[model samples]
Target: MTDMVEAPSGSGWKLLAPVRRAEGWLASVPAALPLLALRLALAVPFYKSGLTKWDGFLQLSGGAQFLFGQEFKLHVFGAQYPYPFPTAAAYGAGTAEIVLPVLLVLGLGTRFAALALLIMTAVIQITVPEGWANFHLPWAAMALTLAVYGGGALSLDRLIGLGREKM
Candidate 1:
């Protein structure tokens, strides 16, 4: 013998099965998906800029020097940065471009990486408001998203249990 039970229409419990299953499935996904995308989105332009500027790591080609010497300036800073300063700035920017992306992709220290990139994006926007239409705006948007939302479900932060939301 067996017992049978019936539920009223639109009780809503039926709809929960798939949702619960999906939620459970989603929990296993690595936290790096969105973060990786944002990382790549953020990294590419700077990587290309780095590449076109120099063939070797940290080696500034003539075009890079020309750009730093002539085009790059801190208009908002209201002060002229002297020699060795531009190279310093360039090195910092280039290093961030290369290194931060890897960290973001790895989902390690994601918030910090996103914050760094966000700062860089803000500086670019401020330094060249004219270029906002092209690169700076998009970079800022992506960086800000990662800065807020973090590395998502597929990441080292989540894997090692560091980035998980606190109870």
Candidate 2:
């Protein structure tokens, strides 16, 4: 057989040489960009929600109080109990919403942060099934991306070379 081979035509393997080149070029893109995008996309919602969780930026109780008392039906504890005490769950969720997003943005503990947000996303879905299509589902999808793919090359985890791990 000859050492040279000809590219086949009409089967789409020959005509798309430029497209193939573009694909090859795309392969060099750093993982950091997508990971950073995931972080930002995931961060804004939680930050806004966290901001809403408090009536005031300075006070920690206002918004969470209203949510636990009226809006959210966390049902974490037995609903039958004299005190449903959604407050505890609310506190956990709120704290996580605020803290996790920041951590994610900084890529500080990307996998761990993604994990916490993933759990919170689950809780949010279970707590408010009505908002599934509106918010929870989309949030969960992004959180899942972060969880499975991890912080990517742009994250602090990557910067610090955390756990000597690869994303």
Candidate 3:
């Protein structure tokens, strides 16, 4: 038998060859890389915000307190309302900003952490409705993406088989 194989007898194959190669190349890319990038992208803003909220370990900054208390307001149906227990809200948001971002970057409890961030994003949108177009919208989208797709193969969740979705 001849080792040579005949090519498909159509010019359509010529046109499709490059497209098929590009598809194959894309398919070869690791899912983990993009997931890691997403995690990092989501983490940076939160981590920076968290850093500003603390003067030292476990100590919330005065500026953070002031913002949550005096500056930030929840806008609801054309009415503005003060945060209930503003100091507590500051502390809670501060802690979450730090902890959740760390968790997201590490890909540990990624979905839970992402969900928590998503909730925080909603609260932030209410607090600063004008930011929706710029900050809140992108953050909400990223958080929701991570919450759904989860940390990929590079994550601790994947290594430990903690929250893997079945194929």
Candidate 4:
């Protein structure tokens, strides 16, 4: 008589096959959730800073010039406006930050909002050479991530079926 070997069925390892499959399905959550959380968390600081600047636009202009004018002199590649460019830049940045952060939080026009925020961040990065070392790279990274990923699953963009529409 030939000896026969039987394969294990419903063994502990076999039982874990379904669990392993479930884990594989859930792995994407780790990557996506953190990006979504970071975007949401950043919205608060951006919105608050924008509001503060809007509340004191004049002061912000003066502050912007005082803080950024010298740096602007180095990297700015355009004809200097007669009045201070830093002030104008500051106001433009403030307005974009205010409006875009709200849109970003709502996930409406997410790509557009991310682009606006990216512009504002680029302006700040260029205008404040000293601060650039600290925040410029990180801000650029975050803005680019948002621009690419776009508000993720929890955003109104997804809820409203905007994600289904072609950009």
Candidate 5:
């Protein structure tokens, strides 16, 4: 048997290879910028909201219990939740929001943080349908984008070259 190997004959493939690479690179640029902006914008509110919960953990927890409690008559989607349980959920939600935002900002554990925030956003949307119209879509979109694209160029994960390994 004779071994056969084919060599490039300087066809159109070679000519278009660079162009394809350039196009691919360009496509990534748009995605990267918006992702960075979204992360930064979302980070501030998320961090602040989380901090507020941490600052008033007791009151917030109580408030959750009160809001979700059966006695409150506040059914999210025709379902009544136990007061104290809602409170616990609120506390957990707040803590996740606060912690994940920081991690997102730092570009550390980006995928994990993004996923956590995504879940938090979903829970909030469900628990408070009224607020869903205003904040749910945007927050959910941002979290999803971050989950997909990860922390941008300015992230600690990228700076340290650890993004790929962790992600």
Candidate 6:
């Protein structure tokens, strides 16, 4: 026997029939595409940003250093605080922006990568509070979704039997 449940007959049900059909169609769509898309979407921005942070292999760019050491500040309760150990912060951020996004795109250690990016997104929000509506919110949402959902069947996580849950 099929597990599908039929909606009761009524005007409201008639109105919702198309929606139900659409829902069914959506259900038929494979989870892999969306999961892969999510991974790529989240990876692109961070990967691009990471590219700008380095001038040479393992070398932090002057612009990145200047921004972290002098320009970027943590906003808290109407107060702005400079980042402590700014050089270390810059290096750490630069490295993570590269490494984590690569892991996310490859779906290797996907949950951990997503969680790291989510944390980075949170820190970015604190640093650039005004970007919440435009950039930070979307990044956080994507990261959170990936973190919770895990990489799907298309992922290394699944191939390696890491995140056994389907996206």
Better of 1 and 4 by TM-score: 1
lDDT, model 6, position 34: 88
Using lDDT as the measure, name the better of candidate 1 and candidate 2. Answer: 2
Which pairs clash in the backbone of model 1? 30-153, 30-154, 31-152, 31-153, 31-154, 31-155, 32-154, 32-155
Give the TM-score of each candidate: 0.68, 0.77, 0.85, 0.62, 0.65, 0.89
**lDDT: worst 10-residue window of model 1:** 1-10
**Candidate number that wins on lDDT, 2 or 5:** 2
Rank the candidate models, highest lDDT first: 6, 3, 2, 1, 5, 4
Per-residue lDDT value at 106 in model 2 = 87
- Candidate 2 regions exceeding 4 Å error are 1-7, 11-15, 56-58, 74-83, 163-167
Cα error, candidate 5, residue 26 (Å) = 9.6
lDDT of 2 by residue, 17-111 (tens): 77768887787677778778988999999988887766555456766877676776655554522226767766666787788999999888878
Instruction: Report the lDDT tens digits of candidate 1 across residue range 1-167.
Output: 11165544674966866776788778766555556778677767766665676658678677667666677766566664433477767667767777787787787877788889888877776667688878877888887877777776677887887676321
lDDT per model vs. reference: 0.71, 0.75, 0.88, 0.65, 0.69, 0.90
> Which is the better candidate, 4 or 6, if ranked by lDDT?
6
Q: Model 6, 115: alpha-carbon shift in Å?
A: 0.4
Can you write out model 3's per-residue Cα lDDT over 28-117, one digit (the tens) per residue?
888788788989998999889889999999888999999988999999999999999999998999999999999999999999999999
Q: Give the TM-score of candidate 1.
A: 0.68
- The residue-by-residue lDDT of candidate 5 on 1-167, one tens digit each, is 11175535678656866786787777667544666787787788788776655446445644444544543333365885544565666667677767788888788877678888888777666566677767888888888878877886767877887565322
Q: Which is superior by TM-score, 1 or 5?
A: 1
| CA lDDT for candidate 5 | 0.69
Q: Which candidate tops TM-score?
A: 6
Segments of candidate 4 deviating more than 4 angstroms: 1-26, 30-32, 56-74, 77-87, 164-167
Q: Which ten residues in a row have the lowest lDDT in candidate 4?
A: 74-83
